[model samples]
Target chain A: MSHAEKKARTTTDEYELIYWPRLPGRGEPIRLLLEEAGASYTDTAHEKDGIQKVVGALKPDFDPGKDNLPGLAPPMLRCGDLFISQSPNIMLFLGERLKLIPGDVEINKYRVNQLVLTMLDLQNEVHDSHHPIAVSLYYDDQKAEAKRKAEDVRNARIPKFFNYFELVIGKSEGPYLLSEFSYADLVLWHLVDGCLYAFPKAMNRQFEKSPKVKELYDTVAKRARIAAYLSSERRQKYDNGIYRYYEELDE
Target chain B: MSHAEKKARTTTDEYELIYWPRLPGRGEPIRLLLEEAGASYTDTAHEKDGIQKVVGALKPDFDPGKDNLPGLAPPMLRCGDLFISQSPNIMLFLGERLKLIPGDVEINKYRVNQLVLTMLDLQNEVHDSHHPIAVSLYYDDQKAEAKRKAEDVRNARIPKFFNYFELVIGKSEGPYLLSEFSYADLVLWHLVDGCLYAFPKAMNRQFEKSPKVKELYDTVAKRARIAAYLSSERRQKYDNGIYRYYEELDE
Candidate 1:
């Protein structure tokens, strides 16, 4: 059996994902990867006092103990004694373990990481579209700046990224990035899914230019595991998280 | 001989660095790693028509060829037939080849990557302090917003990140994040060096609280190769690049 199939049969939860409750923020991508891999894991988001557990994990004055440095932010993955943070980092680690990677391990891993990082960069840009000035500040406070910023995100940034990906998967051997179903695909799919929700009008326009991306977005969603997970309660809705829907910000 | 030592003797410039001309920007960390590892490589920044080379590499419609893809931005590294981008992704790739990572490769690589990504996150935040509203907009156009953003960067963000590093390096095996001087240190050092250049007064205050980070910052600077590179013309000055020193935004 393949590594993923072996992981699927395991009943014991090995990976413990710790993140915030009730939002698909950065944690969503990791959750999707785990779900798609059939990797047995427990999310703190589903646990009792999940919010407090996450809040306590963010102590400013924490120790970086043996084989374990505390996560600077949420979406931290703990496997056995090892604990790590950063959505991309967690995914990179899991991608190798869950056999989500395609081609030779040596060459394609960095490509996978590069694409994931680029997607996150766009994700951050999308987040900034609603809070142009400061993340700490409220949307009501930076509404004007956000509107202008959203204009750049929708008009220039989205098309540039979409066209790049559309051209990428078009020429790639298969529909997914790197011509295989990898974690990079999950990251892009999640970001595009968020983008479509946050800026439905703008995304509809961008999607027309990026039919491949739209198709890939649909392809990832239709995967049996991903489909089941999305309809499941574990999948959090977009609220005031990274991708927010503001009518004024949307074109 | 060690892998790094073996690579040090490689006279052929198999690795070509494609980045902006005359700006450290995101390329500094990659350059530092290459330098410290004593790796032979060519830089497009030093080549004739370097600006055009960097610009042309960023064409959005460029094809993603076999085993080779284009960089979305500057600081793309080309090694042999494989091409990749995203500064952290490039560093992660080079870090392994150059033997810049310490301890077990599997355990430490993710830790190294996570720290590097966090440093880049801070680097992006510092860039945003000056260009909070839009990266496309001129700093003068967003001067008021930049001022407000810089305040939060100095007051809240700087301390939080600095303290985390300070506490981490202090408890780590040595003065480095994971000790033994890896790419994470290089990334953090480059970032701290830039932060110091941009915010002398604020960094001085932060350095007092984060003496370990200050120490690591100094240690990285004193490394023989880094010192030489900093003094040499190869080290680009902080022109209107990512880390710009605006007096009003500084303190």
Candidate 2:
């Protein structure tokens, strides 16, 4: 097949995603993309003994046969004979396959990846607000440090990231990051939603100064598929995940 | 040109890298790739008034004519008309263009990127050990928190990342991550070098248990191009950079 023909083809391959049973966390973005594309996929996290499947896949001795690759952690995507890990990498693969990416232009795709990576950087900072010291430790163990870290994330880091996105939105001709709805917009939407859940007061304050980003978030949330998915049972709630709302962490 | 012929064509295009004047930080990987490829490129960070050039490019008001796109931050790559940012994203582009990535197989490229992203995650965590509270704040301002965070990184996070890489190395048939010496090896080399410099006591302890990773680091360091780069004045020292070593934070 020609390269163009391959790009035009729709994938019939089955996709199985493995992540934590509860808490949207990093897996939510992947779910959003799948939902937005109206693709057929299953989340092992939602299945019976799903969490076990996720845990087993991460084990040192867990084998997915000689053909399949092992994943480093949860939020793994299994498609056909491939077992791919890393949320951004999985998203890139799916985005191209689902034709959810904006254009065939090479530079445009690079721009999309750049935006997704920046969003991931912001998400990690938000996560560190509640667990500034270590991910393995409980929130109570790092409460004091979390308080200090949260303040910086709220007052400085959030604004820095928000302003960068706002500038990006300003550069665009439409409400989305690229002036046309792409996976980048979905990634940003989930991040903003997670921030709102984790630090309501702080995110509200930050949003007030970032009208463009807030507008983008609102625009993405209103998409028919996204709106339906947000209200569906598949949309996991925010809890002790990457974005957690600890009252003490929010000033 | 045919696809194979295009791949064989040498790129004569001029490349300019704009990054911080001092410190390797995230730009080291890009430098290593270019050096290994023997690609002709100029570093704006190394030129006269280079820091000013970097700062000006990042300014909201800076103009790059009608064709060039504005970048969010430094370590931006300007290849002819296209401008790209984000270290890992830039490295991905270079890896493909320079043919430094392993295997023409599509999945292998994904594997290379996944490893690079994982390394970036570890680098970010190592950075957080010193600036746990905020990037804008100095180490002295967050000394107590840094001390606590550094301990966790040394005892817990360092081992976790090193173990993962060691497992990866063990799986490979050669000294490199893929067993054939890809850009992934160069990136890991820089990360390990940074860690040893920033957390001497901690990395020393961690390396004791991760001989494979240490061996990989040693193998990468002995490469002729890397050795020349390391000894050249072009290589920046680690100071007030991402991997800063504060004696008080180390055990």
Candidate 3:
């Protein structure tokens, strides 16, 4: 077979996402993308102790000697023979594949990649809010330290991240960072919403300095697809993961 | 001018980098890429506090608002009129540009992006070890919490992460992943090395079950360019930042 023919034969699944079913968590952005692009996908969430079963199936399949798919973590995506893990990686792969990003190499790559990193920063902040001292410790065990950390995050880091995004939105001079609604804009909106839900007092306090960010969040929140997704059975709240409700950690 | 003609006529710098010079932090990957690719261009590290004058004179013409460059953070890059930021973004961008990644669409994009995400995860773990309680809090202030968090990271998270990477590498069956050296392998090696340096007992205990990971780190350590870079003044050590050295933290 010709090389071109071989290349032509390689096709990928529209999307297959495996994540914790309970909360929006890190899987939320990918969910938003799939919804916005009207892409078809299978969203599977595991039951309690089902994590072991999921890992077991994945473990044997990814064995280099057997499966030929090399990967590090989940949420994993199996596109044709291409097996991929890592949430942001899944987002980028999907974004590029769906043409949800811009055509221009420079601005498009920059904006998409930057937004992915921003999401990483946001994830770190969100996770730390609960597991401030250690992930192994229960929230109740770490509540005191979490409270202290939350106070600092509310006053300082939250505003810093918000201001950064607002600066980007202002620079673009529109609802989107790249002058059009791409997957990133949707993801950022989801992140803002999650943060707000998790830290209402902090969100209100920090977002005051950046009205554009608030405006963008509001606009994206009301998008037909996002609104629909939020109201659908697919959407779950912060109680499961990502952002959890903790009173002392808030105001 | 024709698009090709315009491209030929425009002699923009091949690559441009924006980063904080005082610390290596996240920009090391980009620096390594440039050194590996033998690419040349500008390295902009905005002056912090007292260092403004030194940096200002270095790029007297750079105006963030008006210039062709628009960067919200340091460790950004510019090629022609295009700008890119975020450490992993820069790594993936350089990976494609330098042909450090495979040509196969899925393999190239998925692997490199996954590798970047893994690096980000490692970075988060490192950072949390220090500022586990509060990002805004100084290392000195969070010393107690830092010690506790570091123990959790060393005892639990580090091993899990190491084991995952070992599994991936084992599947690769390689001196390098994907049967070739890619940016991901290089960054992964760096993460392992940094963790070991920061938490010797933890890494030693964790890495015992993962010979492939240890082998990969040793191989990357021998790379002449990286060795030279490490020996040079450019290689910065972890202190108060991510992957900090806290004696009490280590077992």
lDDT of 3 by residue, B124-206 (tens): 77878887766556788888787788878887788777777776676678656555677777788778867877888877877
Which segments of candidate 2 are over 4 A away from where they belong?
Answer: A1-10, A64-69, B1-10, B64-69
Q: Per-prediction DockQ, in order?
A: 0.68, 0.59, 0.45
lDDT of 1 by residue, B1-251 (tens): 36666456344447889898877888889999888777778898899988887888887665445666666777898887888999999999988888788889879998999888888988998999998877788999889878888988988888888887876786685578885778899899889989988899999999889888988888888877778888988888888988999999876
Tell me the TM-score of candidate 3's A chain: 0.85
The residue pairs that clash in candidate 3, if any, are B18-B75, B18-B76, B19-B75
* Cα lDDT tens digits for candidate 1, A35-135: 88888898888999888878887886554357677777888888887889999999998888877877797788888988888899999999989987777
Q: Provide the lowest-lDDT 10-residue window in model 3 chain A.
A: A1-10
What are the clashing pairs of model 2? none
Instruction: Highest lDDT: give the candidate number.
Output: 1
lDDT of 1: 0.84
Against the true structure, whose DockQ is highest? 1
Give the lowest summed-lDDT range of ten residues in model 3 chain B: B4-13
TM-score for candidate 1? 0.95
Q: DockQ score of candidate 2? A: 0.59
Per residue, candidate 2 scores C-alpha lDDT tens digits across B131-169 of 899888888899888888888888888888888888778
- Which ranges in model 3 have alpha carbons more than 4 Å from their true place? A1-13, A46-53, A57-71, A103-107, B1-13, B41-72, B103-106, B237-239
